[model samples]
Target: MAKAFASQGDMTDKQISFTEVGRDLYAFTAEGDPNSGVIIGDDSVMVVEAQATPRLAQKVIDCIRQVTDKPITHLALTHYHAVRVLGASAYGAGQILMSDAARGMVAERGQEDWDSEFQRFPRLFQGHESIPGLTWPTTSFTGRMSVFLGNRRVDLMQLGRAHTAGDIVIHVPDENVMFTGDIVEYHSACYCGDGYFADWGGTLDAIKSYGVDAIAPGRGDALMGQDMVNTAIENTRDFVHSTYRPAARVAARGGTLKDAWDAVRAECDPKFADYAIYEHCLPFNVARAYDEARGIAHPRIWTAERDMQMWDDLQG
Candidate 1:
């Protein structure tokens, strides 16, 4: 069997791919690891997600410097994942933005999450000491917010909850491009440790409704054309369904948590086994799916202790 925390063993460096998905829209992808989006506006720049630490984020800064000298005035978080938001301080952004719901999540369990994530994925948090602390958003919006980089307008919208209750997407209407956080993972395993499976499907539909031509997902490669964008969405939707269906079936049949987990693996592994974080995410994903299948509305906070308990009970 794989190690309890599979990602703890992942330390090989991944080649980063920084590609321009649209006119001024860029995606910084590192193999199948967490991805960040870059938007160069009329005069300033906006970074969609911050990497794991200040040190890790500096690599992104170096990449940005290669293209534009514009100041990174804004850092917008898609959600409250440690690898995604903890690097906010590195940007030195004038404003760090997130949905109001995301900010609330930070207040509720941000510290616990930071501890849990740092333990779960050590490779991503290489420069752990550099994280000054939890990243709290300077500006938060309830529904929608618009930011202007000179004449360019970027819309930040909280369409619906998927990976987390506060997940948001950045839309560039003029370029027909979008930066979806973990809300849309291209070929990566959807880390549903705190996800809402049913709602996530609806959220995917809402993302499609935008009719975006290019998309920068939270993980995997960037989708450049309409066809590839649609495929990524469809594949993500399929992964969600494949994971939840068997687990829900097991739950409905009064099966044990292990039973539900095994059922999910049996159903989903064939298709998603090669995806990034597949093994590392399965236990937590199945646990959450089991809860949601049994009608748990809000996801429970995952502390480092609780994470280990779940891992032992399920994966052990």
Candidate 2:
């Protein structure tokens, strides 16, 4: 089964690939499922964003082996999204890294996110049995950390929150490449349930400041070159704006939740009809946006059953 992705459809079954974007900077992509990044340093490797399970993470590990035999010394999660972080154990990294806000979110709603995402997208959770539990970062930083892997410096910075309260981006200054975990997606759906819509655009801008030549976002193919880089940032901005702002406006106008959904769809579907998983992100996006508009600070927990009920209600 070869892995592939539709802008909006079931992800294809495939083995996945680790594409080298620059010197020692590789992107391990699993069809259209969430992506993982590997930075091969002089002596060791740092993997960013583990897959859904160890079996899945091992698949990425095997790909990393093809490039170098460096032991994975660290697994750096960009945020606390279950689909993105659950595969940490497979990396065998003695040190797992994340943000303070991310750790808080895990303590807040990690279990619910685990259940909610599992039910929402089962295919991505391909070896669910292999998952030990929620992925936790042993080393968490507030803003930034500079890791010197034998002099190949990599900067991990929490530029600003967008996709979540704790989204982080990895910058390899030498290669001028960035691994943005869902902060900026290229041509794929921008998962925005826990995202701050207005802040997302700025985060994209913050990511752009690195003058990234290549970027491997949370989903979709890696963005290569400056032109594609610009497109990715703008596309993510568009998705966040299109989905959340309209829903927020409608929710504020005393419109029914269903009305907010309709308004969001009408505004987004036309512009983002070609984006990957646009439909999948809609119901959750609306629910979150409605909450935000109504003065909810933190996003409500989403259980599997509640996910279906919300989807059913919105889709109806």
Candidate 3:
């Protein structure tokens, strides 16, 4: 049967949870929805990954208020995806931090992504009107930058491109806690519409090298303990391989995009069928994999029109 268009069929509210993963570090997750990570510094606060809208971000702010009254001084955009970065204005942060590459993406296709994602996932874009155009990064860095929140140090590093060319992770060295945006999804599907599948595994390996004690993934629950962290990383890596390997093989034989999609579904469905967003992401994931496997270096822009076209061609 043909599936629902993007996340358009998903309108029910998810249960939100705010769990403290470490000292002054909390994870704000909404079931399978986008997540935000909180870091309470000695004096101020930093938020990682704003939700889809100012209204949704306000819900996160309420959760942050429940924990501490510290002013949110820093807002980090782990990547340029609309669901992750559009709600940035609500934070009222002094510095909006992102990688220089992410800034370039925002300049290149931010508007297209905003429209595509809003149409694709209307439920997440609850307060679409509240967004003040594109959320530009006030401060962007190349390689790595250290943000100090009083005595605490938050390291923002661009290890390697995975979900997007500009993905970065928020690392708290003292606590061995890392908030890996969409680069590392725990019990959730990796939306590879803008991903580099060939490099994603190595990126996962790079993340594993950190020996993280706790991880606040982009979606689902926060991962705690070394075993769980390792499992999450491995699971993500497996998911990447499961999606790309079949598509790559099919593409190698000059197969159609539908063939690649079917191969990926056959390989992944048995293992990841129950994962959140698996159905929503499958087509986009296979298309990108097919492109990368056939040597498309960069992802094509995903406009709303293209989104429906792909869905009709593949999912239908």
Best model number under lDDT: 3
* lDDT digits (tens) for residues 17-92 of candidate 3: 9999999999999888999999999999999998989999999999999989999999998999999998988999
Tell me the deviation in Å of residue 196 in model 1: 0.5
Worst 10 residues of 3 by lDDT: 1-10
**C-alpha lDDT of residue 55 in model 1:** 87
Clashes of each: 0, 5, 0
Question: Which parts of model 2 have CA positions greater than 4 angstroms off?
Answer: 1-11
Model 3 error, position 86 (Å): 1.0
Could you give candidate 1's per-residue lDDT for residues 88-170 as a string of tens digits? 88899999999999999999999999999998989899788989999999999988999999888999999998999999999
TM-score (C-alpha, index-matched) for candidate 2? 0.94
Error of 2 at 280 (Å): 1.4
Query: Which lDDT tens digits does candidate 2 get at residues 1-316?
Result: 1221122245567557678888999888755678999998999999999988887788888888888998999888999998889988888899898999999899988999988777677777878988998777899999999888898999999998788999899999999999999988877788788888767778888888788899988988888899998988887887888788888888778887889888888998888877767767877788888888888877777887787677667656
TM-score of each: 0.98, 0.94, 0.98
